[model samples]
Target: MNAGAINETDICESGSQAPAATQFHDDAPAVAWLREAGLRPTRQRVSLAELLFDKGDRHVTAEILHSEVLEAGVGLSLATVYNTLNQFTRAGLLRRIGPTGSRSFFDTNTSVHPHFYLIGEDTLIDVPEPLVLEQMPNALPGHEIARLDIIIHICRKSRDA
Candidate 1:
């Protein structure tokens, strides 16, 4: 198979089989972004990247993205979506956030900042203000703090007064 092509033999990180054939669309920005991130610009990857980054920085779960792919008439499995998201995260092209439970949200914005989780809507919103940490606790003898994630859960206030 040529570069940027997705064939049946291309196995996803989840160990699931990929689609038999997928048309590769020429997405210049997505291709350049993937190359700069040191990731191969596969057909599925380019399609998903376009959908993820075309609009703007936002958060999306694998399931949500799978639904979107299906809606866009692209044949991609949920496992593939999960695998691609993880790959993008490892490449520093995306950030993963799991505020609670087993659900994971991939954010296109990789900047260091806090987030507000809308409990009712099950959505995450970036906190505009800069997060200030007065002091950070020392790490263990051999380990150092790699990163910090802060998620503030919010819900609509009850109107029954």
Candidate 2:
């Protein structure tokens, strides 16, 4: 090997490779997730999935994801992000949190649990443990409660930490 030459491992580890073209294939775990979710793992989808899954469970909005994609230099549009997020939600890959003032958050943790929504900061924080409800409200006349979701709104303290 030449003294200043790079190898495949170096290229792969450098984070400079073309993400859409080289990072994931049909056999990749993210790709498998798409397949399980009944989605086609296109290059763009794979790239977005990589970002969403690389970190642990998280709550993100389309706008936030668009910023992230832009920072990563991924050539994607906000509309595309919204579309992908909606598709992921419908396919059960993600859970939609809320439409807080025309903005919705997509939660990677799809399990049933409570969340804390910080009002001032507009952030969503997951509750570490499951919350047990003392009593569930009775379903309306002819309807049944399919699920129960509780969101506690919080505000910043007056004094600084």
Candidate 3:
């Protein structure tokens, strides 16, 4: 497997650019999830989970993910892809980011922390973990913050004016 490539199995083709199909291994979470979640281990879901787990510490847009699946010739529909993503998100396996620019990205890591977005470059950087630990939000009289998420958007300065 290439440095960033996740081993995914597909009925599509053998020569896709992503990587080769990988068999079940002790460490692959896909295999474990199948066993733990009572899932039947369908080829599509397994392939998706493996990619999610193996991609470690990376954010990916669904389009990019679908392209990879299609490149592998998995023949999965976009709706199915979205459905599976929503299922995983509900299962606490993924974090769904709302509209960021024109694209939405999925963060595989569940551990909470702030994020910085460089709008000009469309780059996302995870804020250092320590910052989250030190700051606590003040609560209102009637309601408290159920979740604290910090996303900072950034942009580069243009030379004009």
Candidate 4:
């Protein structure tokens, strides 16, 4: 995996066993953003929001975020992180992408776009340009296509040509 890439599936599945308790300062911008999204700006929510949005656009899993929160000296449970992320997703503040049933990634950029998932590196990268599909498959009788999610998986080449 690349530097800073989180490949620990165990941690992702099971949140931190124990987290230290620490005080968190209020983040004005995060509070405002949360309120605008119709979500209450609780201390935990504000703290997580600040960390998640401080960096531009990026992808993260619950475990990755939980680890970051701990590193920041914040006292938050894995469950809390999961709940907050789900709330953000429901409010359209984030987009959830599940490459497989067992793993999911939260994208800070809500805009519609494709992504490239590095197989061994366990990282997700933006595709840069929009993809144009030449044809669309017909939806079932009364069903309609809500949206399209395309993720291209890439891996390293072998040592031998």
Candidate 5:
């Protein structure tokens, strides 16, 4: 082996390749989640929702969601996920994030609160109300105060740190 050869162990420690895909369970509980949210139960809707929320509160873009769907062997088109997200957003089951552009994200937490984006690791964490919002302005002049949102982007130090 060359003295500077790449460390394969650093990439795949198990010494075996990970499966390229996974399949999810499509049973009654998934249906109940949809209905509990007052969303009309449909196979496609339930399947994707189960994938999105089953792992707990997380943010995902349509592309990420679509790829996850494919990884799960759902065999649905990306367009379907996009459309479903739009509908779900309208239905108040999911929140449409990213006013930035195509790089949108779907958040499973519907509650009124803020989020923390770990920019370095590309992860999002829900910041509870007390940590930030508790200190917010209780009253805004001439503003009806429909909602309040705060996004804190974080980054970690590289090896230099």
Candidate 6:
């Protein structure tokens, strides 16, 4: 498979695209979803989409997605998972959150909002609603801020309380 290709199962005669079938299967909605998002729906892409969309909006890291794919009986490498994720993000189907430490979490919800990052646990959850900034900050001399991300760090409550 090419570095940009996700699945080797189904490929067109040109050796570059997935077959565009009109029929919709259990996974067909995922294919359609990808297409609507301007992305080719390959086997791997559809499978990953199903997992990512199965439980509604949720955040997942590439490692977590890789494990889920393996548990789902899908044969996919970690690298492929990473590539597919980046593709999906670029296509605007998902959102990518930083290397807080070493890895990033792919948020299924692409809308702009704040998130709660659990320290030590390395987990993230939506903040229920978008955060409200009291005052916006001014960019430096030649730079401009494109967006803002408010991540709140949380920890377990004291056992006594």
Ranking by TM-score: 1, 4, 2, 6, 3, 5
Q: What is the C-alpha local distance difference test score of each model? A: 0.79, 0.74, 0.61, 0.78, 0.66, 0.75
Query: Which residue pairs overlap in candidate 3's backbone?
Result: none
Candidate 4 residue-wise lDDT, 7-115, digit = tens: 2122223332222244334658998887788777778888899999999999999999999999999999999999889878877788888876788899998766789
Q: Please provide TM-scores, in order, for all candidate models, with all chains considered together.
A: 0.80, 0.78, 0.67, 0.80, 0.66, 0.76
Q: Which is the winner by TM-score between candidate 2 and candidate 4?
A: 4
Q: Which stretches of candidate 6 lie over 4 Å from their true place?
A: 1-27, 157-161
Query: lDDT by residue for model 6 over 96-161, one digit each (tens)?
Result: 887386879988887567799988798999887745565665669986554455689898898998
- Give the alpha carbon lDDT tens digit for every residue of 42-113 in model 2: 777887898898999999999999999999999999998888887777676787888376768898987666
- Alpha-carbon RMSD, each predicted model: 9.8, 15.2, 11.8, 9.6, 16.7, 10.3
Question: Across residues 1-161, which tens digit of lDDT does each residue of candidate 5 receive?
Answer: 12123232222112222221333345667677766755666778877887987898888888889999999999889998897887677566776556344467778876655677777666667865555222444346764334445677767777988
- Range of the 10 consecutive residues with the lowest summed lDDT in candidate 4: 1-10
Question: Which predicted model would earn the best lDDT?
Answer: 1
What residue pairs are clashing in model 6?
A: none
TM-score, structure 3 vs. true: 0.67
Task: Indicate whether candidate 3 or candidate 6 has the larger lDDT.
Answer: 6
Ranking of predictions according to lDDT? 1, 4, 6, 2, 5, 3
The stretch of ten residues in a row with the least summed lDDT in candidate 6 is 1-10
lDDT of 2: 0.74
Least lDDT summed over 10 consecutive residues: which range in candidate 1? 1-10
Whose TM-score is higher: candidate 3's or candidate 4's?
4
lDDT of residue 86 for candidate 4: 80
lDDT of 4 at 46: 87
Query: Per-residue lDDT for 109 in model 4?
Result: 89
Q: What is the number of backbone collisions in each predicted candidate, taken in the order shown?
A: 0, 0, 0, 0, 0, 0
- For TM-score, candidate 2 versus 6, the one ahead is 2
Candidate 1 vs 2: which has more lDDT: 1
